[model samples]
Target: MTARHVLLLTAAAYASDPDGPWVDGGLVLRAAARAGLGPSALDAAERAGLERSPDGRLRLPGRRAVYEAAHPARRRAAHRLLAEAALGERLRPAGLLHRALAAPYPDSALGTELAAAARLPGPSHGERATALAHAAGLAADPEVRAGRFVAAADQARLAGRPHRARELLGRIDELTPTDAVRGAAALVRGLLALRDGPMADARASLLLAARLCPGERALDARLAAAEAAWALGDALAYQEAVAGQLSGAATARAFGLGMAAALDDRYAAGRVTLRRVVADAAGAGAPDALLRAGAAALVAGDVEAACRLGSRALAAARALDARPELPRALELLAYGELRAGRHARARTHAEEGLRAARAAGQRNVLAHQHAILALVASLDSDADTVARHAAAAQDIAARHGLVQAATLAQWALARADLARGRAAEAAARLGPLVRPGPRQGHFAVRMLAVPCFVEAAVSAGDLGAARAAVAEFNVWADRGYDPQAGALLARCQALLSAGDPVRADARFTEALARHERAGGDFERARTAELHGEWLRRARRPARARVLLRDALVAFERCGASVWAVRTAAELRATGDAPSHPEAPGRLSELTPQQLRIAHCVADGATNREVASRLSVSPRTVDHHLRNVFAQLGVRSRVELARLVDRAEATRAL
Candidate 1:
């Protein structure tokens, strides 16, 4: 029946029996959210005191106060108020009329209200399935028992636990074989196949189920399977499969089908499908569909829509005490917050999700949580924490046969090493990840490999290989895949190798900008340290000293002992080091920027040429030479060049 009709029936039942099932409000709210209704509507309903109980029933306050005091005619008015409030714009009269007839005392005022609402269209098949699933555990009828088992399977699939759902379906088969039971079993098998990493099997199972059920059950599975096939590049199969299922499935099927279309780059078609899915799911109380709708909204870059849908999903998940969906919902919320530059809130949500995943023993979720944590740590420039978490992730991935995750963990480790001045070690560790090979099963893992390869090549001073690696990275970046800070560092190193010192300096500045935007100062400090080195090489010792000193402070704050020590060494040599209260001027300047600049100039340019190149007049170049005469710097430009070159050579050795 229509949502309005259901609400009217629920209201009448409540009026007649104050304790009757009126908990359908939650389900209605869920459906409305899926249908793309504004959060304001749901909030209004909540404020109006429509809360769903844990048992999936509506809990209205002071049930006897309104119904008992009202006449039969007034009772109908109450039912209308409840129905209008619950269904909102989604209500129609046809479904309401049907609900009226189904209620007790069909000729009563309550029944009349239901009859009027019954004229409206009812929830789509997918919504019906969702509602059935939500109320299944409380249902006692044999048909409902079977349907509940199926709904259980659907829940399992949505939570990424297809294996458990499959097992449950197997048990359901032992009970009886109704159309719903058989259809749900087939759909469950298809979902299981999809989860098992076999799109072909999933498609076949779903296609067969589509012919058998020809309702929401088969339609949902078929569309999901089609999308899987499309993702695997079987476009023709996807089209044929979708075409066959489209004529029978509910509008919500379009959402799943649209997801497939989007994967195939049919953006327009995907948009059309998702819109319908949202509408239909909103009409039928389906939290899973609402979550999908929210995700789609996010993909479309509709921040408002995403927040509305996500809020609804979160509410439903909370109402149901479904802890599994909680993390997924929280992740979406965190993503939104992160986009808005609310890093503190984002981190809070991310940590909450991690805790939930750990409590539930969900390894896949745990892996994702750790990856996010690594990103946070990278932003914070807490190299030790990043390394520890990344290693843990790799260990978990290896144990779970997740090759792509292992690769990412290795990349994270390489980044940690690079930050600690262990470039050679980082190069060795990241070398194997960048080699040409067949596509890894995980998309994230494969994408990660490109940056790791670039970093290693640049670190090892293999400019040719780095250039080649960057060509691949540029492709992914062009496709809208922006790598994280660690990857950006690799890009900066390549720019430095290309000798565009200015652009390289700009890239370092950009990295720091991003780090600060991500709500952490650690990466900014590290970038500043690198920028100082670049500046020092460019003959800007004054500015370099300030940057290096700041970096040293950051390193010490983050407990980065290796980096702190190295920065201190650079500080002393620059003659800009902070004075020790106990031993002032105890540190000696080992090398100076002017000396390096002189070496670079004399190695290739004449005195007049060096003066022009360094933006100094010829007279100043001669004056510096006179000072050079007094200092062990020597008399002639050639001798000065020799001394500076020898010092550089010794340092390199």
Candidate 2:
């Protein structure tokens, strides 16, 4: 055969089921050989770089253009040859699947066999059979096709393939399915919408699912409806959705009630309910139930339990290959790590979760991960990274009506402003978010940002506004809603009392005492810096130097570079430099993405190679490389390589 024929035959093997990410190399060769192409077809395609993917799987490198370019008659012949080869006495499931896929028309006999195969219990069988059923146009028998498609859609949704799930559901819609089958498909669609949303559409689909679905699925739909209502910021609707879950004993429903109570500020009741929910979910060993309880634990201020539950949920999800739940588990873990002041671990989890969320098409989860990454950047005082991540998050949140994600992104932006000494701007940006009005942010999130707002208002000389915010924060602190609440509240009070030296001195002392008990290094350092600055202004240089030195050390430990520079300046003003100031890492100034790109480029990889490795567009790699060059002050790839080598060598010291 000619080279063109070899390529077309190989392309036809993959085009037969183009939805999958990869086709087995052996399967491709066998199918092509059966199509009158020699076994040398694989060798020729490999030589042409058509099988150039590092995984050795058969897929068109740049879209399916090569397969689409083939003549229609040739493609059908190739599929028929594969189907003919699959007809054996003791047929394996894989061979049987090929036969079903090559059906010339909507053969009801072939449809029945594939539908039965789909109903067989296995991890991948259902998805494969249903995809083949639809791709082969097997909807002539509605009874066989409808049930199979509905189950496949649910499996796709659970596996975190939202687009695939929707495609299957759309196929089901073309058939005359029974009410139950249609309701089942709607349930999966609603769940998919909740993950990749327009909250309004998710709520509508879920309500329909609840009305038409039966038993457990109805309960599941109602529970998801409650979450969608909460995300939309409709308090009345949230309550109604929660009321609908009252009749169910599902562990997820218990989790929903606990989350609602916590959001309502009944932390004690919420914690109690969530504790039982966690135990029940653990006994049931359901990944989804574990995620619901884990999220509730985070909201209840039980960070330790939340982390534990998150770890368990992640393990279970991976073991069962539950793709949709994986990102949710990671989000819970990242949030817990952030609350506990494990900034490095939090950033790691957020980055991994961001990638998984992208793959799963979980838009809401992606927004949440972006917001978390922004918060991590804020702690590092990296304003540009903060702005970039926050912008990405807010863009998604606005489109999806995700109040919590939007609130978190706004808080990150305001915090970045404060770090850059734009106190007035920060205060202006955060005031409406913290205060109650139509433009106010989510209740739980806005409350967490109150300390930042108070600090900004105080810095901008708006003492009256600062005082009111501090008073409200004091109530939350009294309730013990956060482990670091006492320290943050004391710091806020000290800021408001700065004009009264004696009162301010007392509050500063109280803040430092509370800081000794708090977990967050960055927050503790901020309090110390404020106290030291006040002492220096009071002409108490001796005491100021001591506090300033400690603050500088704490800031450096937490990688808060901006805060470290300011604290170092304060220490010098008090006649003391940061006495053992450690030398910074050579690549310390680079953002995570820039660092990755620089390392890749330094390793002698071309831009295209780096882009493929990172699963990003070449243009994105080029854009980040420009910023990396500017930041590192390297004029060419050669200088960048030298700089990276020296940095690596210095780290070895």
Candidate 3:
């Protein structure tokens, strides 16, 4: 038999009528003739494949491969023909479907293409199949139209036209509203809001989408909601989003979950998630993971690990030419430097990141940059710069609802007030953040500011407040809020709750060691200064000299002139030769950091050696080394060393 006859026979065999007898040979030949096959021609066709069994029943030879030989289009046509031909004669469709498919579809390029297809008048089988396929495409149900629009919107977004994507999403409502369409629409809106502005809007839209989304798309919608909640600074929402297990061990899923954990300040949990992402990662988003994991490491107090990951992130971003990631990488690098007391290098990184973020129109990064700059200025005792940058950062962070950025900027201003002896006012300024009510503060930021608030409160004679802050800090310490927190807590305890000189001294000593272990030079310096002050008041000026000298050197290394001058006064009161009141020469012109780098180079320390002592990168050491040479009008390390020594000796004389 011909191919059509074989298909007819196959369909007839599989689709038996419950109310009718098996189709015998005579009936098959009659149906074929009615289907336009001539009787003599059908008899002349090959019948080798359609052999009969001993019982006289047709048993066509079939194989799995033979079954796949026919195209789906042909199978569908034969099946439709059998449904009609089995009942009686074929009932041809009126021209309505044909005219609809052939007509110009409003705003549809697809209909135009279908119209171009030949609508032949003759009864050829292929032409009939083609016409039916065209009509079927035009008559697709509303659910199919919604899915098509969702797919088109995704493509438009990938093509960098989010407005076009939103427009296509709007077309979904015009067709029909299925759970799938509404869920997809909400998911896209959430993702877009995440990138465009405040995350509150994104979180709300994503929550509804995750709840209503059905089927395989459910996991994706949940991921979107979790990320939106993280961006909106809600840790609880992130917790719930990852509660439902992911569908697979997908690297993207790991990355999303890992980022949520990190933003929620669950660093240990985030690290676990990041490790999973790394194991499953195919190098697609590994660089992004590196950046986020590095920040988490910094917060966890792993200084060396943070530096290692930061260096890798910077290199990867540059290698991939991932301009969008550059600002974040640079921002993290600056934070690492700031934590390590590498103020000069931190300033460079923050300034560079600010320019990159502004050019990229990343306002979130811009707000963080200004906050970092504010802190840097506060450290440098540049009150005017600190005030200006802090105000700018405050405005941006508040307007954008950035909890962390705003908190950091507020902390910077409070630190400045504390430096200027306005301890009472500083205590008032930080009290709200240090003891936040309900869900009002960022965990990491509050963790960082608590120690400072305790010192401020104690200095302002609010002993009860100081003790309460200390208790709160102990709670954070138990949860492993910060790596350097132990040392800071000890120092606070020594100042606020210690009963004897011996206990206070022991606590101070422990805090100093912890600061060194954590590689926080500025913190160590401040601790030494406080301990020296305590010793001086106890009539042990000689014992105070050693810690006072160390504090002076550390303050100089961090470019903390305001604190350094105070240390100098404390040193002078200890009967030590203090820094010259008006130190003459180029030494005064150089920054405290530059002066310290010069001292290290003058003592013949290598770049790596200096970097180890200063808790900074060798590259940072080299950069500061070069600056020291240029600023002092020297040609080499030798000249830079000689010039610095000569200037110092002259100032003393």
Candidate No. with top lDDT: 2
In model 3, the Cα lDDT at residue 269 comes to 86
lDDT over C-alpha atoms for residue 259 of model 3: 57
Candidate 1 lDDT for residue 348: 75
How high is the CA lDDT of each candidate model?
Answer: 0.54, 0.74, 0.64
Candidates sorted on lDDT, descending: 2, 3, 1
- Candidate 1 achieves a global lDDT of 0.54
Q: Write down the TM-score for model 1.
A: 0.51
Per-candidate RMSD, Å: 17.1, 9.0, 19.0
Compared with the true structure, what per-residue lDDT tens digits does model 1 show for residues 1-653? Answer: 13333333334434222223344554445544444455575445456655666666666565455335546654454444444445443433322432342334433343334323322344322232333333343344556557666765665555445455665576565567687567767777775654343456667777777767755656676676664554343556666676643654455556556655654557667766665665555654456667777766644444456666767887887776554566667666665554443445656777886777665445544655565565455433335577767877666655544454456566666665664456777767666556454533344244445554565566678777666656656554433322243435444553545478767766776766665644434445656776787777778899889899888777656544445545655654565522422221111122353554455444534345556677877677666655554655354433443344345434454
Candidate 1: count the clashes: 25
TM-score of each: 0.51, 0.78, 0.61
lDDT of 2 by residue, 127-233 (tens): 45344445335656666667777776776676566777788778866678888887787788888988888888999888788888888778888888877887776
| Residue pairs whose backbone atoms clash in candidate 3 | none
lDDT of 3 at 134: 40
